[model samples]
Target chain A: MDQFTLNLLFVGASFALYIGIAVWARAGSTAEFYAAGRGVHPVTNGMATAADWMSAASFISMAGLIAFTGFDNSSFLMGWTGGYVLLALLLAPYLRKFGKFTVSEFIGDRFYSPTARLVAVICLLVASITYVIGQMQGVGIAFGRFLEVDAFWGLLIGACVVFAYAVFGGMKGVTYTQVAQYCVLITAYTIPAIFISLQLTGTPIPALGLFSEYTPGGEPSGVYLLTKLDQIVTDLGFASYTEAHRDNLNMVLFTLSLMIGTAGLPHVIMRFFTVPRVSDARWSAGWTLVFIALLYLTAPAVGAMARLNISEMMWPNGTEGAAVSVETIETDPRYNWMLTWQKTGLLDWEDKNGDGLIQYYNDGSEALAARAAENGWEGNELTNFNRDILVLANPEIANLPGWVIGLVAAGGLAAALSTAAGLLLAISSAVSHDLVKGAIAPGISEKGELLAARISMAAAIVVAVILGLNPPGFAAQTVALAFGLAAASIFPALMMGIFSKRVNNVGAVSGMMAGLLFTLIYIFLHKGWFFIPGTNSFADTVDGSLLGIQSTAIGAIGALLNFAVAFGVSSMTAETPQEIKDLVESVRTPRGAGAAAADH
Target chain B: MDQANQTPAVDKEGRTYWKANIRLIAWSLAIWALVSFGFGILLRPLLKGIEIGGTDLGFWFAQQGSILVFLALIFFYAWRMNKLDRFYGVDEE
Candidate 1:
């Protein structure tokens, strides 16, 4: 069969499986829709959480970010996975024990303020909607590349599929569907990694293969791969792979932001509620991380190995020796991946100075200019190579099979769709549970709540799909913003609710508002309020950073501000009602396991 | 609400039970902070050269390796905490 047909078959089979699960596990009651009736197996919930957590960013963009930036870009991998540690230890079990339907509900009730809940909902909606646009873009890109269509059309098609599956399924359908999605995406991700790792380092495990010796055609078995990579990168005027030039302070903050963001995200936290007990919540989080680690561990290796392969292909004769001829770039059958990627308009090059040879360099470096003048190069010509293309192109660069490439297309879509479905569920539940029942109509019927949840879900998908069509920013780039909002607003508040008994309603509300508001303003001052580039007051630079903390790191500061404000304000106020305090104690106790307290 | 049906409570020392819970949280949070924010971020500079796999110790902690430890920590917490809860007479039916 043709490659396109095979891709369709693979992707179609996965979609069929998802729809089948949706049908089989369709949620009937509000309990099932919101919390899966608190009966999910730890292993099953773990698989679902993996799918919810991976998203388009982890599956499609993370490896690509590492592939291009080398060691300096390790922030993406570290930031994404390390957050699970925070989730597993600090957040998951407590929240599961608290036994709420949504993150906002926890905030609202714990702090005793509807405004706090509403604000949490707003943050959740904004972060989720903004984040979903990235997944939509992933779905479109994967579909566009595999199906050979415009990404916007692919996005539209993806939106329709999500609307049909996600609007009705809620958590019950989604939990089961995500199990299937986890399998598809993980299979798609590992197959190509194993193939390339075996080819490069003779190890099936990509993480270990990354550290082992290079297999550069005739090189010895123990040849250090990174040393070889560093030598080649320096020779080509690129920064050394292992050396980090970015501010250590800023890198630390960025990683912290991603960590908090990962832990605080509503879609991810909601998964714990599906499991049976507080203990299961604990076990399930570990399982989720185990599954996520499968990809996070491999991403850095893929990036390093792909970078080595691409650079070698461009040079043909080693980087220190000779450059590839212009004729070779255009005419050589070996450089075909460049042409294939170019069709996506994500990779571009122009032959400058009337020379057919395209020279790629860091024109930003002052030292490289003198070196370039001797080489008769005016500027770097390999422009417009979008960083997100790195992972998708890795398979082609490694000269993998057509079926593997087809599987990657399907895998990327599964990752994007699974996350989008989870987010939609969260948004719908928050609207139905927190906003509608908690504030708008306190006496909402179960049937009414379910109807409203579906409507909100359908609407959320529409908004996400529309934004996906004309993504206001780079695909993976907006994830930092989502994480920032999460870190700034959600993580600190949840932690405080569990750990600190002193924080009251006015305190928690004000703190959350302050954290989210300040983080948003700082991000806006740098990334532009709605992410329109020129409208921002400050640039995304170390100089422009607040106290030299990068935008990614600023969320940590917001979180600190939240904690401080909540404590400062609460200490001035009277104690919380005795019942609420008792409720907090009860959640922690796990006493009389099945107590259905109206207050709790 | 069925008030009569809900009060089939266990008679236990609530003070010692909660204190035990507190002790567990304190210990777990300490290690939790250590592995993630500690080893992955703050303490990363201290262990710069000690290598694991192909990358330095810090990078391993930040990405692949720290998560493994976290998995171990959580499951251990689950097992031990459950035992502790049962001992303190807080476990459910």
Candidate 2:
């Protein structure tokens, strides 16, 4: 079959599978809708959580980030996976035992204040909505490229599907669908890696292939893949592949921020509640990471190998040889993906000097710029190479089979839709469980609340789809904004509540305000207060940073301030009651692990 | 509002449990910080010449390798902590 037909078929099959599963696992009660009846096996829960956790960014953007930026971007990996450690060890098991429906519920109850819960609800909404924007944009781009539709129309189609899937299915529906998605995405992801690895290293497993030697025809394997990649990239004026240039201290802190932030995300934490028992929670977390690691380990190999292939393709004669002539672009079938992508307007090239040759270079680099002008170059020709294109473009570079290419398109959609479902579940639950039942009514029938949950779910999907159509920024870019908000608000409060029993309502609230205010002001100074560009006075560059810390790393500092102030203020206030201390004591134990802890 | 339903653990006999919990958290967090942020970033320079499978040790830690180690660490903590929980008569009954 033609590649286009295959793309359509693969995507159609995946969606069909998702809807089929959603129908099979349809929610039968309020309990089933919200927590899948709290009967999910540990391994099954882990698989679903993995799907929920690794969204479009993980599948589409992470390897691409490493591919382009080289070593400076390793923080994305460490920060992302490390957060699960915090979640499993510090948060998940305990929260599962607490058995609440929403994260803010825990906060409100622990701090003994509706106001605290309200603040938490706000934080959860801000982070979840902001996070969804990334997935929405991801759906649009993936749809536009694979289906040959306009980006906006593509986003609309993606939005409608997510709305249908998320609204009809709920968490019970979502849990099973995500399991299918996890299988599709992982299979799609690893297949490409394995193919490329076998061709390069003669190894079948991409994870093992990464550490193996590489043979380029007559060339020996001692020109190890990374070493060759580093030489090629640096030869082209980009940084070395294996060595990073980001500030060491800040990189460490930034990765820490991502890790801590991941643990604090309300949506991810809530996944643990789907499983039964504390030991189950513990084992489930381990299983989730195992699935996630499959992609994480292969990503670097895929990234490094793709970079080498593209560079080699760009310079057919070698790194020191002449650039590929523009004639080849139109004539060579290997360059078809680039030509096809160019029509999207997101990928473009200008001849600049009309030399009939396109040059891709870091024109901003002084050394390259000076040399380029001597060769009568006006400027680099390739423009608008959107970061999202790398993963999509990978198969084209390696010249993979049509079915494999089709799988990638489906995998991207799966990643985006699975996450959208999970987040919508979080939003709906917070609205009905936290806002309606806890704060508004104080008394509600299970049936009535189930209706409310479904209503809120429909409402949330409508809002998210509308926002997705005219999202504030790029998909991957907007995701960082979500992480920033998460780091600022939820992370601090959650950490303080767990680790410091002295953090009373007054202290926790104050710390949240301080952290939120500071992070917001800093982000606004760079990203615009509301993320509109040019409204901000300060630059977002390294020179513009406060204390030389990157904006992403600021959350860690915000968290510190939260802890210090919360502990500081709590000391002056009355200590928690003896009973409250005992509550803390009980949450610490793994015994009585099967029954939900009731708050008195 | 939340304190109403807490499973009350008798603390007078088990205050040492709190100390032990704190110690474990401190140690786990330290290793977590060290592997992820330390070997992954700040001390990467110290590992500049050291390489594994064509990449720097630090680069490996940051991207592909450290995460696997982290998984092991958490499970180990859970296993060992389960032992600790039983030692203090705190294991889930």
Predicted complexes: DockQ each: 0.42, 0.56
Residue A504, candidate 2: alpha-carbon lDDT? 89
Q: What tier of docking accuracy does candidate 2 attain?
A: medium
After best superposition, candidate 2 residue B24: deviation in angstroms? Answer: 2.2
For candidate 1, the iRMS in Å is 3.7
Q: Write the per-residue lDDT of candidate 2 for residues A116-233, one digit (tens) a residue.
A: 8988887787778878878877877788888776677777887787877776655334477778989999998999888888877778898777777886653466767777787888
DockQ agreement of candidate 2 with the native complex:
0.56
Task: Give the C-alpha miss distance for residue A253 in model 2, angstroms.
Answer: 2.4
Q: C-alpha displacement of A216 in model 2, angstroms?
A: 3.1
What CAPRI-style quality would you assign to candidate 1? acceptable
Displacement of residue A274 (Cα, Å) in model 2 is 3.3
TM-score of each: 0.91, 0.93
